[model samples]
Target chain A: MANNIYIGVDLGGTSIKVGICDENGKLLHQMEGPTESEGGPEVVIKNIANYVREIVASSSYHWDQVAGIGAGITGFLDIKEGIVKLSGNLGWHDVPVKKMLEAHLGKTVKIDNDANVAALGEAWGGAGAGIPNLVCYTLGTGVGGGIIINSQIYVGSTGVAGELGHIAIVPDLEAIVCGCGQMGCLETVSSATGIIRMAKDAVERGDKTSLALVEHIQAKEVFDAAKQGDEVALRIVNRAAFYLGKSMATLAVVLNPQRFILGGGVSKAGEILFAPAREIFKRFTPEPAQEGVDIVPATLGNDAGVIGAAGLNLHR
Target chain B: MANNIYIGVDLGGTSIKVGICDENGKLLHQMEGPTESEGGPEVVIKNIANYVREIVASSSYHWDQVAGIGAGITGFLDIKEGIVKLSGNLGWHDVPVKKMLEAHLGKTVKIDNDANVAALGEAWGGAGAGIPNLVCYTLGTGVGGGIIINSQIYVGSTGVAGELGHIAIVPDLEAIVCGCGQMGCLETVSSATGIIRMAKDAVERGDKTSLALVEHIQAKEVFDAAKQGDEVALRIVNRAAFYLGKSMATLAVVLNPQRFILGGGVSKAGEILFAPAREIFKRFTPEPAQEGVDIVPATLGNDAGVIGAAGLNLHR
Candidate 1:
């Protein structure tokens, strides 16, 4: 039998990425094209099919070797049905994505939210490779998460499993309303937006800090200031890490994944963020759950989405 | 072909319960006998073997009809090795339960902790029947939890997944040390022990409460007092229910189980505990996660242990 290859599509508002992965989830070939989502779902779907074919045509593997196609889309999705129920970024509603893609490419198709797809990518080939159970946290504009169990993405009853940012870790006294309308969610403190908010709040409160000098504050500025031994900036960084570690402690007992993978821009703060999160995880987690469990960074970076989507047909 | 029957053994400190369950996890027959811990591991092993034979012999089912045996023990277990690493309740250390049981029964045998077994029982034939994913909470002396994914008990790495009681939920200022040595754990406020403690604290603090008139405060007294409109007792009950609800909210996002099953003695408080817990769960959970999800009571009660034990081989 010929070796099988998988196709993964990272459908974004501005660009669509397509990658061909070998059985081991190693990217063999890749191509990128504009999404032009404004052209409507039909045009976007055709672009995805064309990109997938182009990737395979450029690769060493034959088209017959392509086992299946999978996509990681941003928005509320009906994963089982492969439908985009609502996508603010794509301006899509009730788009029958799987059926359209499968019709164009004549192959089985699968779809998952971007966070889950990225986590699966890491689990299949990145930081969580060979680890059957793991959790991934993406700390970008908002916190995102994916739960991987038995090497497959675990999308809970409504495909909302691993919504880690909404874990509600902050105490009421310190809590602020989250974008999800919940109070004291993990994202309210641990996300890049949350860190930036804290920095701005500190500056507005007239705390002695270098952040006051920055014209427009960002999470990077906060981390940079903290790295320079700025006390106020350090407090903000600790607060963000504190909630993250606490959320992980809660997840440790609930899911008991073998590893936790941290990704996204906020995680780039390096030891300034990870050190306290790891320490807090250890302090709050019961000793038994913490044994042999580790916290690590996602190794795939931007490629996790494409690689994980390719794994959907195989791992799922 | 003959129908298969499963043998389940619930090993406790003072008693050993044995039952026969059909493929559906329905308990056909059950019997209980002394654990005879003073006689040690060897005697208990023989006793369990005898009970297995006695039940099948007394019933219409033949010995050959029995397919496999499973036991649920209370302890720290090396599940993969089928060893009880430490069991404070059973006074056991490093007992190879699966090996000994397989030796006596001459059949395939499996073992898991009591909490996981009960949750499996509920998932298999009780309230969560036909639900492939769910979380179960046993609010007894200490809150115990089990995660069921794809109809199987998810023990996680090192067999410590689903230890919900130790989830640090209370704010640090108001939190106290838990038996697990963690502060502000969910069990500190939500377990039966937690409820009793709150009542004792209220009385000792010179609060004018009816609980002060009681000779020995139990969880039941607190519930009864609350039913009678005792303000302090109602507050304690509400506090217990509050944490349980909050923990469920956390679980909803993490596991996204189809249902949340509440079992154990404390759950018997019915509407008082359930109403508040459900309301809190709704308040804390994001709309999408809570959609189509429910919090319900466990139906199998004590039988859950034996039935879930019997299901280990089938489910696992």
Candidate 2:
């Protein structure tokens, strides 16, 4: 099975990324195309099929050598049945993605949420490689989590496990309404959206800070300003770090994963975010659960999705 | 093999309870003896050995019929090596409990934390019987928790996994210092100590309530007064139930266990605690994760520890 290959599709609202990997997890070929989600689920499905065929056709391996196909889709999913339960980005609801792809490609198809796929990719080849029990946090617009137990994705009974951001760690007094309609979720403070929200609030309150001058503020701009000793920016960054670390401490006692891999846009704030998180994690976690446990930035970055989707054929 | 039996020991500060269970998890014989902890670890170990021997001698089964022995003790433990890391109740530290028991009885011996053993008991034959993935919360003086994944205890990297009560779900503004020294742990607000603390605070604030008349306050009194619609008592019970439900909602997205089993002294409050917790759980949890999950009282009561200890030989 040395030449046995798998096709991975990282499907998003804007584009579809296709990659082919050999049994050893080495990428042999890649391609991309517009998602055309405006054309609805039908068009997106067709584009994914075309990309899979295009990637395999451009590679040296024959179609017969491809073992299976997998897609890292955005939004909620019925993973066992390969249905996209609801995806705001893709404008899909109850779409039978796996069935359509398998029928078109004539290969077995597997699908999972983008977060879980990213985690599988890291566990297969990135930061958490070879560590069976690890959790991945993707801190983009929202905080997404994926739990890998004994080298497999742990989808709770209904295939919706590992929602770390919503762990309600905030007290009622300090809590703001979360997008999920809850109060004081980790996402309300730690995510890129949350960081920007805090920065905007500080500037709106006439706080003394450099952020007020920036016409368009973003999570990155807040981090950049904080690096230059902007007090308000620092406060926002610290608040984000505080809740993020607190959520990790909460998770430390329950899952106790050996490594916590941080990814997505906001995590790139570097040590400005990670330094305080590590310190807070140590302070919050018990001695036993804290020992030998590590917090590290994700290594794969954007490619984690495609690579992780590729691994689904083997790891899932 | 039909007549094969396993010996279980539930060791505590006050007493040591022993039981014999067949392979099918039915208890066949039982007995109890004083812990005699005033004499230290050696005395406790000897008492355990004698109790196991006596239980078998009094039963119909002979020595050959005893397959193994398991002890569930309070405190930190190294489950793999069967070492009681630090048990305040037993006044033990770095005790090689499994090795000593095996050498004394000539049978395979296993040891685990009391909470984990009790969880295994419920998973094996108690409330969560036949359920593979379940989390048990024992809300006694402190909130203790155990995780059962695939019907086995989930000890993390350093044998400290399943510290469910330590999850920092409470925010700082509404937080109190927990016994574990962390601020705003679920145990700080949801445990029996926390309930009593709230009751004390109500009385101190000079709130007009029936609780002020009761000189010696207990958790049961709070529940009794709440049943009678005492304003202060209902407020205290509601706060406790709120945190407990919130913590379960937080855990629901992470582990997605099939059931959340509530046990210990506070759980005895029945629907006054459960009805509100269930409602809060539904409000906080995402629909998919909440679909089949159930919050129910533990059925095994006091026998859970002994039965769960006996099951360690087969399950762990």
Candidate 3:
């Protein structure tokens, strides 16, 4: 590895995690702070700066060895221009994030959408290591994806690449509404909310299961209940797996990725999630693609974000 | 611009089209032949050799100046090995096509899946020219795709990259059975055969429309009838477009493509096929991608296969 060190910042809706990393993609030090998103972009920027400063101060390694800094924030972005074009929850439109951070820190900064950065993190040092082409999808409050091809991120002609959550896994039939306000999106059916929606729908229709008797429930409750042999919860998780597997099969035909690493909060359901998902994938994917494709659970957990973000800085 | 010439061959069950071109992708000559696919792999090899000899005899270009030859065939493949691993339609399996043809022609030969070659042709000389990131989908008897990134084909770890047809567009419960032995594949609902299948299903259910009374049904026939005010046919075609559009939206996410070029036989339906597809695309795709992505019809038409194959030679 080179002698260079780098900085990593993970910008989430409620908090920010900042860290220092070596060129080999090792995290050296870390710091965190509340995003105070309601206070708006300027406040979040200040918080990000504070977090970065704390990491620099705390690291045993000196700052002079750092090459630059990178941030992973949720939004539509202009990677080439170093701007956050539109982030819904953040209410940010065309913010010159790179220049602002560079101005404050006196160091160069590279900012990418959080999902994109997470994908870069995975590709560089996490679950996707050594893979030339892959897609990392996180099923959380919403769905997000990162596309990596030939060891580099595929940022598209524009920067809005790998938005898998918005793809119409279901189309025109009045399915769940995606955050983008579209109907029948893969997001509506594959995320945690989607899983709950499915179980709730089954109950409303009088499908007999243990979940039908539960007080309000979430996707995790469903997965936990499924592990305990709840028919309704098991059914709901299975439904999500079916779609997730189908989506992977479709993804296979488009990108022909050698590996697919599933992560995020909902992925914790484990084989109750992956087993059926893989079964459906084998059933639905074209024969040739099914031959040797690897569908693995993401090795990185919560650390994926901070670690992946750090990895991004070192690699970039 | 180089003086070196190349030959491109497109192999299908019933017929084959071959073209002669220069290194810059300029076509110099062409020929067509019956595939005689029933004659088995050995006989087909002989036919390919004869076709190459005929092309050489008719060309004024010097044989010494020929750089290489390429072939694109309809089958699952081992691309790097230049083997046709399987073909349900043509009954081919594990045939060393490249070595046989290279030896017969006394020059190097390369082979690729037909869809990949089509994408390559567009990447080198057609609509996707000057663009390295693109997804080329063929709406033929089945939906097929090839991904191009950074001015070259991305054939995944197993040479099965770009299998767009097999992506499960419909959730299993709501999906139709695809010919590839699965439920709800994009190809089952979106290709030329897929459109006809839907039309037949719709008509069988007793919905009155222009196509209900037709003696023969084809994908184009349904599209033409729908144009003249047939409710059932219109519904069928729109439904197919809906699935196709949604699938493309998913592909946009999966591949982060700069362009989505629709080709093959059914694309001839034009706006009727594309307009609704565009609507679904815009509605479901995330912003930036929704605004920036291009869904254009393929430009090479029938000659795409040959040209694309030639491109494979020049590129791979």
Best-to-worst DockQ order: 1, 2, 3
Q: Compared with the true structure, what per-residue lDDT tens digits does model 3 show for residues B192-219?
A: 8888878888778888877878877888
Quote the lDDT for B92 in model 1: 87
Q: Which tens-of-lDDT digit does each residue in A23-124 have in candidate 1?
A: 888988888999999899999999999998888887778999999999999999999999999999999999999999999999999999999999999999
Ranking by TM-score: 1, 2, 3
**Which residue pairs clash in candidate 3?**
A73-A114, A250-B167, A253-B163
The lDDT per prediction is 0.93, 0.87, 0.80
**lDDT by residue for model 2 over A1-316, one digit each (tens)?**
4478888899988999999877655667788899999998888898999888887787788899888898999887889999999999988999999999888888999999999998888877788987888989999999998998888888877777888888776677788888887777888899999999998898899999999999999999999999999988998999899878887898889888899999999999999999999999988887767878899999888888998898898978
lDDT of 2 by residue, B65-104 (tens): 8888989999888889989888886778899999888878
Chain B: TM-scores of all predictions: 0.98, 0.97, 0.92
DockQ of each: 0.87, 0.61, 0.57
lDDT per residue as tens, model 1, B47-154: 899988998999999999999999999988989889999999778899998999899889999999999999999999899999999999999999999999989999
Count of residue pairs whose backbone atoms collide, per candidate = 0, 1, 3
Once model 1 is optimally superposed onto the true structure by TM-score, how far is the C-alpha of residue B204 displaced, in angstroms?
A: 1.2
Q: Candidate 3 at A166: error in angstroms?
A: 1.8
Q: What are the clashing pairs of model 2?
A: A171-B171
C-alpha positional error of residue A288 in candidate 3 after TM-score superposition, expressed in Å = 2.7
Score candidate 3 by DockQ.
Answer: 0.57
